[model samples]
Target: MAGIDLSLKEMMAIDGALGAAVVDYSSGMALGTLGGSKELDLAVASAGNTEVVRGKMRTIEQLNLKEGIDDILITLTRQYHIIMPLTGRKGGGLFLYLALDRERANLALARHRLKAVEEAIAV
Candidate 1:
């Protein structure tokens, strides 16, 4: 397994990756972050997205879908935000948040890379 630092570095290697962060949804805090521009406040984004994840999870429970969330995707005019919640016992309630330049990123590849990052990331 990769350490958190290395895993975040790998995530930034993805083409068009604007920034990436390992965030704790419960606390709305970023444990590690890389590659954000002035326009992208990784910490603020992390906290805001935390609410998004929590809201969705609560909705799922209310609906009684009996399903687990894999990830949440938010597409903007210029960027793509990908929120991937970790699943293993050690990773529950934590997630990897990635931002990409829509014009330069390949969404499919980014998704695949994020999944690999999640698997390798050691809490």
Candidate 2:
């Protein structure tokens, strides 16, 4: 399995990746983060996204759906935010949060890369 640091670094190498963070959905805390601009605070973003994850999980339960969320995608005029919950051996109640420039990113590839990163990430 890949270490957290290595996995995060690999995520940053993805095309159009503006920022990446490992966040704890349970506490809305970012354990580690990389690649953010002055205008964007990754820590704060991570915390906010925690609610997004929680809300969806709650919705799924309320609906009594047996499916698991692979990722949550939020599309904006200029950017795309992707939240990928970790499902590997060491990853539980944690997620990989990524920000991408909509103009530069390939959504399909980004999702695929995030899945690979999640699979290899070790807590």
Candidate 3:
């Protein structure tokens, strides 16, 4: 299995990736991060997306849905943000976040690659 740094690097290899992070949703902190610019601060994005995850989880619970979230997608005019909560025992309470440039990204493939990255992550 890949460690945090390796997993992050793998994520950056995806087409259109601008930033990536492994975030702790419970505390709203980034445990590991890569490839963010000044305007796309990964730490700040991680914290903000934690709320998005929490809010969706709460809504699911309130609705009593039996299913879990696959991923949360936020499509902007110029970018795509993907929030994938890790479900494995070692990955509990954490998530994988990736940002992609809209013009360069292949959404389906990015999602597919992110899933592989998630599975390979050791912590």
Per TM-score, the best of the predicted structures is: 3
Any runs in candidate 2 off by more than 4 Å, and if so which? none
Cα lDDT tens digits, model 1, 49-122, are 99999999999999999898889999999999999999888686799999999999999999999999988888
Give candidate 2's root-mean-square deviation (CA, Å).
Answer: 0.9
The sequence of per-residue lDDT tens digits that candidate 3 reaches over residues 1-70 is 9999999999999999999999999999999999999899998999999999999999999999997888
- For residue 121, give model 2's deviation from the true position in Å: 0.4
Instruction: Report lDDT (CA) for all predictions.
Output: 0.93, 0.92, 0.96
Q: State TM-scores per candidate.
A: 0.97, 0.96, 0.98
User: Lowest summed lDDT over 10 consecutive residues: which window, candidate 2?
Assistant: 84-93
* Alpha carbon deviation, residue 122, candidate 3 (Å): 0.7
TM accuracy, model 1: 0.97
